[model samples]
Target: MSTPSATPATPAARQSLTMVCATMAGAIPMMTLVLWFVLAVDGIGEFPESWPLLVVLAAAVGAYSICELVGFRTPPLQYSNRPTAEVQADSWRRFTASTFTRFAVCEAVFLISVTLAFVADSFWVVLLGAVIALPLFFWEAWPGERNQRRFAAALESGGIPSYLTGRAQD
Candidate 1:
């Protein structure tokens, strides 16, 4: 027994959401650049401690794989029997929540990389981490119109009506 909100998501809300995601996604590359600059100017001289950086790199690879699984796929809940409005609201809620989670995880990847680069006095860590992360940041984390369409279609196929998918009206 769920009561759907009478007011659906407004276009303004959709635009705001997209902008927020895009802004955060855009920041990642800039942060990577900053790391590169720091390493270029006053890099810590190389140390023989390679084991710790290797361990962190391995963890980063694992984290990237997990992030991919968690970021893009929505939980397949049975909402076909529910009212379209209720289903739409639920879908919207899930989509928005997951978008933020994906963004956070992606940011974590960059953070881990940048932090390791500083600790290890190596620029390569940031580069490798950015390589693993930037694709997903642009592809999955950014809530562009294309992503919205895909998400809406996925939900529609799962039993939510196309109209009730809460996409921003053109």
Candidate 2:
């Protein structure tokens, strides 16, 4: 697809898709955080034997938060109020940043949560939560390598043409 960074002269379709993906990048993490909290509250497993899983959980969640924060704070996306393609590009950049920063933040949050659970003896919630949640996380995150290709193909196919045609009327 024609990513905004594909080249400045890239078709508006590519740029537009890039923007949508970027916005998605920011949006997903916010949702993940909510789900993570829910899972934490529910207790899928214990943190003692499940430290590794907790780490994974925290990292994934943090990635989402970091991505959202970065996207929300993005220079370009925040630059204008139009809510269009350029915003997408800027927002996508946050998603990219999330790919790295998310791990750190997620880990930190998990550790804190685990500690709090332990100190407060809120064991069942976190332990059971981890047990039930890990598999789901793996499966949910598994589309790792396929995301970009799938999105690119989705965009390159017919999205742009339709969008442009619709926009032309305005």
Candidate 3:
């Protein structure tokens, strides 16, 4: 097993990660706003009452909570005796997959709430959902420098081949 290092992610990797974060940060809010606008223009026609809305809201919250808990606690990336670059690439792919899963959960919450609003013809329901989901989105999807560093640390600790680390193979 390779020893952990304090080394940060490579520049290109860092930039790509930053771009992913930025894109997610922008896209989620825009999606919520678009949904809100659509709801407003289309108007709430008719559907069930508060009970259905509450249920959906609860489910959304539950899903978000589960995703957050799972995503952060578990490192999806696996360690192997491969070239450093190849290992890094595999780790990045796993990280992206995990991140996207969290993103989807957030998106689902907003979309479900918006759909509920459309069905129930209640702007308040949509508003409530968006308000609830927005924070979750920011919390889970907003990748910052800290996150990048943590990911790098995790990768280091996960054990790369000694050859990659310029150490003699055991």
Q: Indicate which candidate wins on lDDT.
A: 1
Candidate 2 regions with alpha-carbon error over 4 angstroms: 1-66, 69-98, 128-170
- Residues 3-95, candidate 3: write the lDDT tens digits: 777754354644676587678657656766676576655564344577757866786768677764665544434655567667656655655
Poorest lDDT segment (10 consecutive residues) of candidate 1: 161-170
Candidate number achieving the greatest TM-score relative to the actual structure? 3
At residue 142, give the lDDT of candidate 2: 25
- Return the candidate ranking by TM-score, descending: 3, 1, 2
| Reference-based TM-score of each model | 0.63, 0.28, 0.65
The lDDT, on a scale of 0 to 1, for candidate 1 is 0.66
What ranges in model 3 sit over 4 Å off? 1-10, 41-49, 73-80, 145-170
What lDDT score belongs to each candidate, Candidate 1 first? 0.66, 0.40, 0.61
lDDT of 2: 0.40
> For model 3, which pairs clash?
44-121
Give lDDT for model 3.
Answer: 0.61
